[model samples]
Target chain A: MLIGFVWLSLTKAGVPLDFSFLKDFSKRLGDGFWLTVALSLASLACSLLIGVACAAGQSAKILPLRYLCNIYVGLIRGTPLIMQIYLFFYIVGTAWGIENRFAAGVIILSVFEGAYITEIIRGSLLSIEAAQIEAAKAVGFTGRQTVRYVVLPQMVARTLPALTGQFASIIKDSSLLSIIAVTELTQTIREISATNFRLFECYFTLGVLYLCLTLPISFVSKWLERRYDYGN
Target chain B: MEIEFRSLSKQFEDHKDVLLPMDFAGDVHALAVIGPSGGGKSTLLRILGGLIAPTAGQVWIGGEKVCYEGAAVEAHRKKIGYVFQLGGLFKHMSAIDNIVTPLIRVHGFSKEQARARADELLGRFGLLTEANKKPAALSGGQQQRVAIARAISAKPKLLLLDEPTSALDPEYTTEVLGIIRELKEERLDFVIVTHEMGFARHACEKVLFLAEGQLLEYGDSDTIFQQPATYKLRSFLGKLLEWNI
Candidate 1:
C-alpha cells in the first residue's frame, strides 16, 4: 500500500528507486538467491524429518523417549532463534571443526525451525481420535502400518498450514545467517548497497524478492488445506 | 469359531478395576455384548480386539491363547475386524480408498485385487455411487456402511461392532442393520455391541451381558430376553422395554 508513496518520496528526494542497479544487483545476488533457496529447502527438509521424529518420540510408548523429546523441544522454543544459531555456530560448529560455514548455517536454521515444526506435527498427530487407531488395529494393521497408512496422511493435511509458516520462517531466518558472512541474500544486498550507495533501493528490492518467494508458499498451503478437507 | 475369556480383567492406574476377573466360554459364532453405561461393553470389545490389554488373565480366540503385545496377539489381530460407532473412515480417503487400505495393506492383496474387492463391497453395501466421496461427503448410513466394507474387506474371521447404530437416525439404522443381516447370511461371524435389542435379537444368536466390567449373563437370545437370570439383566430389560413402549 505504501509502495506508491515510497516511489514518489524517493524520487522527490533525488535518490530515485532506479532499475539500472537491478542488472548488477541481480547478477550479484543470483548466487546468493540460489544459496538462500537451497538453504531454505535444506532446512525445511531437515526440520520436517526432525519434527516427525520428535513427534514420534513425544508420543512414544516408552517414557524416557517422550521426556527426551519434551526437553529438546522445550529448550529450543524457550530461547531465541538468533541466539541458538550463534551458539550452534560458535560452540558446536567450532568444536567439531566444521570448516563449512554454509553447512553450519543450514544446521542451525533447521535445528531452530524443528522445534516449532515438532509442536505442529505432534499436535496434529495427537488430534487424531483414538477410534481411528482402534479401527486401524481392528483391521489387523501393525502399529507401523497404521502410522504409515492412516496417521501420517492425516497429519500432513492437519499440519500443512503450520508447515508453510515454518518454511517461510526458515527462508526469512536464513537472512540472519548474513551476520556470519554466509553470502546469502541479505549479505549480497549489503555488499551491493555499500558499493553503490543505493541502500533504499537494495533493501526495498530485497523485501520484494522475499515477498515473491513467500507468496507461493501461502497459496500452496491454502490449496492443500482445501484439498485435504474431506469434511470429517 | 469360539471365544473364551479366562479370568480376563482390566484395572486402571488409579487402582480402580474397570473389568473384574471373569471367565466365559461360548461355542456360538455371533455374541451380542449388551450393558448399561460404564458397564465395560466397549472395553470388553476393545480388549478382544487387542486395542487394550487386560490387566490380567488370557483371551482365547478360536482356541489360540492370545498373549498381549506378542506375536500371538498380532496373529489373532489379523483375523479380527473392528468398527467404531462413528464409522472411523479416514477423512483424507474416499469411500473406495477407505475399503482398499485394509485389503491392500493388511490382507496383502494386489492393487487391482484390492480395487476389485472395494468395488464389490461398495456395490454390495449400496454405496457404489458414493465411491469417490470421502466420509464427510457421504450420508451417515453411507459412511458406516463404507466403514463396515473396509473392516470386512480383509475377510477377518471375527468382526467386532461397537455401538454400531448409536449415532444413526432410524432410516440409517435400518440401512446399517440390513448390511449386518447380509453379513450373517454370508455366515460371517461377528460380536456386535448394540442398544437396539430388536436388531440384536434378529441379528445375533447369543448374548453376553456385562456390568461394571463383569459378565452378568451369557445366554441364548431367548434366555437373555425372556428368561433373564441376573437381576441386572431383568432391570435392564425392564428399562429398555419401558423406553421402547
Candidate 2:
C-alpha cells in the first residue's frame, strides 16, 4: 500500500519514472556490485581470521597474550568505524605510502568487523557444553587439536548466521567507502544522479543493486546453518 | 592397569575441600566409586583422567606418578579413557566417526584400521544400526554406547567412567550394563562412579563408598553389601536400599 501511494504521488507530480537510465548505468553498477562483493568476501575471510585469532589469544592460557587480545578487541570495538577509516587512510596510509585505497578500505573494514566477529565466535565457543571439552581432553586430544577438531567445527556451525549477517552489513557499510572516492556502487550512483539529474531513479537503482547482492548471501547462510544444526 | 591415589586431595579457590586426602594402592579388575552429590566422585575421576589437576599430592595410574607436567600428563591421559554420565559424545561427528577419528588422529592408526576397530566396538555394543547416526540422533542408551566405543578406541589400559548410567532410564541402563559386563568379561580394567545400586552389586568386584569427599567403606562388593562396618557406610547403604535404587 505504501509503495502504491508513493508511485501515485510521483506519477501525479510528473516525475519521469523512466528506468531507461539503467540501460546505460547497468554495466557500471554491475562492476560496482562485484567490487562490493569482493570487498565483503575478502574482508569476511580476514575478519574470521582476525576473530579466531583474537578469541584464541583472549582465551589463551598464557597471561600476556590474554591481556594483548583483550586490548585489541577493546580498542577496535571501542572506536567508530568512520574514524578508523580516517585513521587508516590519512595517518597510516600516508605514513606507510600506501597508494591503494581499495586495500585500505578492505583492511579497515576487516579490523573494524573483526572485533565484533571475535565476540560472536568467542561466545559460541563458550556456549559449547563443558562436557564436550572434558571428553576431548579425556580422549587424548591436545589443547590445539581439541580447539581445531572438536571446538572449531561446532563453533562454525553456531556462528554461521551471525557471521553472514555481519558480512551483509559489511556490504551496507561499504557505502561509506564513497567518502574515500573509491568509485564503488554508491559513489557511481551519486555520480550518475549528478549527471542525469535523476536522483530518485539513481537512488532506487542503488537499493535494488544492494538487495540483489545481499539476498543470495542470506539464502546461502540459512541453508548452511540448517545443514550444520546437529544439536537441534 | 592398577590405579592408586596416595595423599591425593583437591581444594578450590577458597581453600574449601573438594576431595579430602585419600589413599588407595592396589590392583583390581573393576572398582565402583559410589557416593552422594558434592562428594567429589566426579572430581576424583577428573583428577585421575588428567582433565583436572588436584590441589595437592599425586596420582599413580598403572604405577606411573601423574603430575601436571604436559608430556607426562598427555601420556597419562592416553592410558586412561573416560566417560561422563551424559555420554559426552561429539555431537558433530557420526557415532562411528566419533570412535573412528580419535583412533586415527590420536593413536596413529590407519583409517582402515580405525574403521575396523570402530566397527568391532560398535558391533560388540550392539550399535551397528545407529553407527552412522550423530549423537543427537541416537537415543540416550545408544549415545552412551558410542561414548564407550570412543573411550576404548585407543585401547586404553584403564577406563574411568563418571556416572555413565546416571542419566539413563532403566531400559537404557540395561543396554549399557550389557556393554559394561562385556568389558569385564574381556578383562578390561575400569573404575565407574555410579548410583545404580543393582549394577554395582552385580557387576563390580569392589565397591567404594565416599561421603562428603571421604572414603568411608571400600572392599569386595559382596562383603560391603552384606556387612557395613561403619555407621556412615551402613546408614548410606540403608537409605539407598530403602529407596530401592
True contacts kept of each: 0.85, 0.77
**What local lDDT score does residue B240 receive in model 1, on the 0 to 100 scale?**
90
lDDT of 1 by residue, A1-232 (tens): 5978987887788785675878866777888888899999999999899998998899889999999999999999999887887888888888999869899988888888888999998889888888777777777778898889888888888899779877888999999999788999999999999998988878988998898888998888888778777665
RMSD (Cα, Å) of candidate 2?
Answer: 2.7
Candidate 2 docking class: medium
Query: Once model 1 is optimally superposed onto the true structure by TM-score, how far is the C-alpha of residue B2 displaced, in angstroms?
Result: 3.2
Clash list (residue pairs), candidate 2: none
lDDT of 2 by residue, B1-245 (tens): 66788788999999889989999876868888887888988998889889899988878877778877687787788887888889488888999889887788788899999999999988888888888888988989888888988888888898888998888999999889888888998999999999887888889999988889888888999998899888887888788889562
Best by DockQ: 2
State the lDDT at B201 in candidate 2.
82
Error of 2 at B30 (Å): 2.4
Q: Enumerate the chain B TM-scores of all models.
A: 0.96, 0.96
- Predicted chain A of model 2: TM-score relative to the true chain A? 0.88
Worst 10 residues of 1 chain B by lDDT: B67-76
